[model samples]
Target: MFEQAEAIAREMKISRSAVVAIALEEFIRRRIGIVPLGEKSNGKIVVASTDN
Candidate 1:
């Protein structure tokens, strides 16, 4: 996973944090459709798909 992120960051010329942030943003946008970012959840860690 670290290697993959490094590859992506290198190819995109972005920081590792940016890569993670972008992934998180897309995840929240897709899964928690109605809720916005930074909202508290139900204390459950749902598995986000990595099909892209």
Candidate 2:
């Protein structure tokens, strides 16, 4: 996950923290059944639920 985020930060020309922040916010929105309002980037990211 760190590698993926680092790659995104590099590609988007944003700080790692900024990338992580956006990702977290989008995740929270999705968890609550809200359509995330984040900028729609190219390419798809798939996240799945799992029991810890």
Candidate 3:
């Protein structure tokens, strides 16, 4: 997992911390049943809501 993350970070031109932050945010949102308003693409995050 760490290796994969490192590769992804390099590919995205972002730091490891930034990659971790995004993963954490996604985990938290899923745990709390917060669904994104629209499909994600190009590393963009859409609206978040609890109204799944």
> Judged by TM-score, which candidate is best?
3
Models ranked on lDDT: 3, 1, 2
TM-score for candidate 2: 0.64
Per-model TM against the reference = 0.60, 0.64, 0.67
Candidate 2 C-alpha lDDT tens digits along 1-52: 9999999999999999999898887798789765555334354343533422
Quick one: best lDDT, which candidate?
A: 3
Stretches of candidate 3 above 4 Å error?
37-52
In order, the Cα lDDT scores of the candidates are 0.75, 0.74, 0.78
Candidate 1: misplaced stretches above 4 Å? 34-52
**TM-score of candidate 3 on Cα atoms, chains taken together:** 0.67
Q: Write the per-residue lDDT of candidate 1 for residues 1-52, one digit (tens) a residue.
A: 9999999999999999999998887687768673334454586445553544
At residue 5, give the lDDT of candidate 1. 98
Cα deviation at 7, candidate 3, in Å, is 0.5
**Tens-digit per-residue lDDT, 1-52, candidate 3:** 9999999999999999999998887788779776544657456766654542
